[model samples]
Target chain A: MIQYDKISSRDAFGNALLRIAEENPLLVGIGADTTKSMGMQKLSEKYPERVINIGIAEQNMTAVAAGMAATGFQVYAASYAPFSTLRAAEQVRTFIAYPNLDVKIVGGLGGLSGNIEGVTHQGLEDVAVMRSIPNMTVVIPADAASTEVITEEIARIRGPVYLRLGRGAVEKVFDAGYRFQIGKANVLKADGSDAAIICNGAVVARALRAAQLLDANGVKARVIEMPCVKPIDADAVVESAAATGAVITVEEHNIIGGLGSAVAEVLGGRRPSPLLRIGIEDIFTESAPHNDLLDRYGFRPEDMAARIGQFLSSFNSKNEEEA
Target chain B: MIMKSSVAELREAARLIRRDIIDIAYLAEGPSHPGPALSIADILAALYFRVMDADPRNPGWAERDRLVLSKGHACPAVYAALAGRGYFDRAWLTTVRRLGSRLQGHPDMNKTPGIDITSGSLGNGLSLGLGIALALRLLRKNCGVFVILGDGELQEGMIWEAVMAASAQKADNLTAIVDYNHFQSCGGTDEIVPLEPMRAKWESFNWNVFEINGHDMEEIVSRLEMAKRFTGRPTVIIAHTVKGKGVSFMEADNSWHQRIPSKEQYDTAMRELAGGSE
Candidate 1:
């Protein structure tokens, strides 16, 4: 089992950005007074000449980053999830995405990670808004280790990509040795019988635990970690459906236009399956602790397990009824 | 590179742009602000013809300067200047707002070669130009980014946000030219939302201010050159101009904001423009 650590992911991103800044003179970092929050302070401190602190202007920061990118600088505009994605969304759409500029929007506090900050700060709608724009790559790394891997991957890629990291603590799901390719799903546990619980980001660990509970009950649950939501690996999804006949998508993001929706779109087009989406119901969240919010929003291991059980029973009943 | 163009040449180009604006207004289903286009023709000519270090052969060159038409409704004037600049073939001007044409009602950066940003939503170009200027500064490239703001477009809060950011950053490479046509879509700016202290507003935001006759090609060209030459502060050129400059009947007329001229009016406007210069 890979060790999970939030600080580790933060360190990976910070260290990678610093190293990239040092090596690539074209790389410039801009933060909206969240260098410490997003772990960009290391880069900011090390490369003070290259980093720009725009105080609290997320919109201007994003637009300036796009401008810097246009001038041949590899720019990373970092900020809190809500303000960075939604507040400067127009800049992201026109200046960055529409022009397909080489600017990386690294948003901290994805999903309910900013739990203490409440609904106003929680970036539950980031994915939904970002996915609507054309020519955008969206990635949610499951852990800190994956964060480092994906950061390096994005640094090398040419187009616009949104790399979202969570707040508080998160588990590490990869190591220095683990290789990651963009747009490819990672199969954590593979078994053919019961059902496949496909998940991303913080929900990966919860889905794994749910799969383990199902395995004890003679239900061979396969858990897959789909880190990249856009350009989703359709073949893996189709294969999982063919094997299990029932698929459940779990994520910390809302039910609309996120991982679950992307997976459902693929499955709907190719093969029909009994799909149960496990995420926030269509409702705005109130202030609560991280764990409390997850539980309240149906993101706990028990929640996924119960949803999978219901889906399995429903799939069997439907088959029997058809027979 | 030294730019040496005569006033007569610049005025001729402005007159041709005015003619093109009237022509395009007629083509656009008789629903365009032809008068506003005529008003800004001289300033647009000064920039596209005499100022702005841009190459028609390579519009997107890394070291080349940038120009953004923040007052986007006056696009007929811009299209004329761009055609004159040879950024695209002059024939494309006839395809303005037509299907599958680079020329749209407003400038689309993706479609037009010389256009810097897609601006139809008013009060956005200043901020967008700020981004471009900031990028040039970050890259440490010696180039200027100019944005032409309408007197009415200043009603947008984003423009002030950009103005503050530019002043705070001391983005000397950037310059904003307010058409100061003294009118908006509704009516005269003072009658609608008074900005009598327009120069003070920009000066308070920490910008170097220069007010001039926008219709004067010499003044327009000289002030733009000065804005590009000077450093350590962002500059604002508040050019006082008539809304429907060359057209007698439409000048300062609010109805001319988006109305296309009738055949009789077009004939008279064409005669006036043609009678002036080229």
Candidate 2:
């Protein structure tokens, strides 16, 4: 098992941006009244001239970032996930993605992580929106270390990117030895093939914990952590479907068009298999503490493990009886 | 890098650009915004011929001034200017708005050589120009950015946001040209969302405002030159123009906003524009 550390993904992104600023003098940060909350305040403090605050305008922020990027400057637009992805959806699509400019749209407060702030602040549909747009590379880091890694990699990629981040510290899912490729999936546990848990963002650690519980129950399962949601690792998904025959996808977004939908699209195209989508179903969640919301949504490790166990055993027993 | 085009020279160029706008629209075999494109012929002529310090041989030359046609539907005029400037072959004008052509219906920076930024969606060009202007300032390059916004496009809420931000940044390197052509897709802008006391709106936003008759060859060139040198804040030139200046039937007519001219109408437009030739 890999050891875990507690660090806010937003802070990790902010610090990585500072490092990027140190190297890239032309790096510009554009925000819409979300500098401090979205991890851009430090960059503003350090390089006042570099950070161009656009007040409370999200659409203007995204379009302006595209403009800056077109002018040959490395640009990042930060805001709440909903505002950055949906509110500025057309600007991101037309100006940034259509031209394929190298602008990273960093959206904070993804999913139920901002639970206390209610549905308005929560970014439940952002992943779905970003992934659907053509030429947009969608990324959701599992933790601080991975956020830093993805941020560094995103700078090198010469196209538009959407970096979805959550509020507060998340459980670490990787170590110093961990490797991150933009479009490859990382297998945290490959011990068993009874079931495969494919997950991303703040839920990868929970998926790992659930796999451990399945192991204790004498059931071997594989756990895959996917960070790059767009240009997804189709090979990993196909292999997992072939090995386990039962795939479970977990996320902190709407189940309709996120990791579940993306994985299903890959599997339905190549490898047909039984799949279970675990996330916020097609319903708006109410305000609560983040952890309580997780538990309430059946995203707790123990709850997820029980569901996985029931799914595999029930399906297998039916096959056995039929045989 | 320098070409001083006199008023007579600019008038001839504007006449040819007007002819190209009609040619591009008539050749498209579909409805195109000949009205909007015709309105900005003189403005683009002034900028391309005299105002902007851009090299036609090298579209991506560093330190060269940039123009973002925020009102992208007027790309026919811009395409005519770029082709006239030798950015591409004049023969390509026949293939405009056609498949595999670099001159798309809307301005695309990647597909076209001289386009500085891709813009079609309204209220976006000003912010894009501000970004370029800000970057040019940071690099200490004296390159200016010019953005053309339609009168109807000014209704977009985001335009005001950019207008406010541009002033707050004190981006003196940027200049906005409002083609106050009096019409949008549906009808006259005054009949829809009236932006009357136009100069006050920009002045209240802390911009350097200049209103001029957009079709006047001398006034268009001189005022644009003045705006190029104005400093301390962003500038906006509200160039009052008829929607279809050269074509009498289309001018100030709401029905011809994006409608392409029939063969007979095209011939009249061609003859009228050609008559202004020295």
Instruction: Please state the error at residue A322 of candidate 1 in Å.
Output: 3.0
lDDT of 1 by residue, B1-278 (tens): 73657888899888889888888887655366786787789988888887877888888888888887888878878988988888888888777777787887777777888887666557677767877887787677899998888989888776777788888888899999998888888788898888879989999989999999999888998999999998999999999999888888888887888886788988988888776334
Worst 10 residues of 1 chain A by lDDT: A1-10
Candidate 1 per-residue lDDT over residues A75-147, each given as its tens digit: 8888978998999998888778887888888888888888888888888878877877898888888777788
- Model 1 chain B lDDT-worst window of ten: B27-36
Candidate 2 lDDT for residue B151? 95
- Total clashing pairs for each candidate: 4, 0
Candidate 2 displacement at residue B121 in angstroms:
1.4
lDDT of 2 by residue, A1-323 (tens): 54555668888888889998989998988889887777877898999989878889998888888888888898989998988998989999999999999899999989888788989989999999999889999998988888888888898887889999999887777655557788999888887778889999988888888889989999888999888889899999999999989999999999989999999999999999889899998889988987789889879999999998888888789889999
Which one is best on lDDT? Answer: 2
Q: RMSD of each candidate?
A: 2.2, 1.6
